[model samples]
Target: MPEVFTNELNLFSGQLYMKSMNEYLSVRRFLGLRSADQKDSEPELSGSSTNVMDTETPNLIKFLRVLTMKIRRNCESIDKTHLGRILDHRTLDDSDFANGMDMDM
Candidate 1:
């Protein structure tokens, strides 16, 4: 069977980054990266704290925001020619349209 969609969407990349950030923070605290001063500055990173998300969480959030912005910019600048190929009827499938047809009898 022929492929219906030309554009591939990788959604797990975002979730992977979040997972890695959590792992890194766990490793950092496990290795005692937190300092006494930081304990006061970022209570979440304190060894006594229980929050899974700490100071490093904000950095990951910012990175994801920037990534989302870049994706939007890329979409805005997409080459219409390539998109046209994906929109071609030969590439269209039931999933791409309502009820697999454009008109009703």
Candidate 2:
């Protein structure tokens, strides 16, 4: 029915949809579903006798900075669309970011 189709469209057209898509992609990347080019782009871990966190902290920070920039660009792009206007009614909270991190852990 038209109503059913409309409902489905609504379900997938707003901030919730965007969040879900972002989470899915993040999980996939964390699970090593990345492309060859992406693998090449990543910095290699050193085999030096240093703490793992010490070696990885810089890379993690750099990756987060780049990811935040890309997410901002995407949000800007989405804001130009009608769906963005609809989703603008909702606000994001720190919990959203924390939730994503918890999932990764």
Candidate 3:
């Protein structure tokens, strides 16, 4: 039979164990589970659990400016595909911004 080692003996599995532990810590931290020896600093579920709106969508004005800068940076000589992609991103950003603003009222 294989001899079992203690949890503290994470000597064999380094990166994998650390990654898993980080994930566990994140979830437990988010859900207000702290170690027995540590204090719980997270707000209670009633106040912290409420979902909030995402108000940080890509800025359409900034997107347009960046797209224009990229085109100008290339001496107005960008390929059709790159230009198309920029246009598409601009359109999507504008639509997203408008939709988010509509929800403000």
Q: Which lDDT values do the candidates have, in the order given?
A: 0.32, 0.35, 0.29
The total of clashing pairs for model 1 equals 0
User: For residues 1-105, what per-residue lDDT tens digits would candidate 3 score against the true structure?
Assistant: 211232112212221121233333432232233344444464432222122211311343234335444543343422232223332331112322233222211
Clashing pairs in 2: none
Candidate 1 wrong stretches, greater than 4 Å? 1-52, 72-105
TM-score for each prediction?
Answer: 0.23, 0.22, 0.21
Model 2 scores a TM of: 0.22
Give me the runs in candidate 3 sitting further than 4 Å from their true place. 1-19, 40-105
Candidate 2 residue-wise lDDT, 1-105, digit = tens: 443343334433332222444443332233223323345456432221122243464464344334433464453344432223223323333354444332211
Tell me the alpha-carbon RMSD of every candidate. 17.7, 15.6, 19.7
> Model 2, which residues run further than 4 Å from truth?
10-76, 90-105
Which prediction has more favorable TM-score, 1 or 2? 1
Clashes of each: 0, 0, 0
Q: Pick the candidate with the highest lDDT.
A: 2
Q: Write down the lDDT that model 1 would get.
A: 0.32
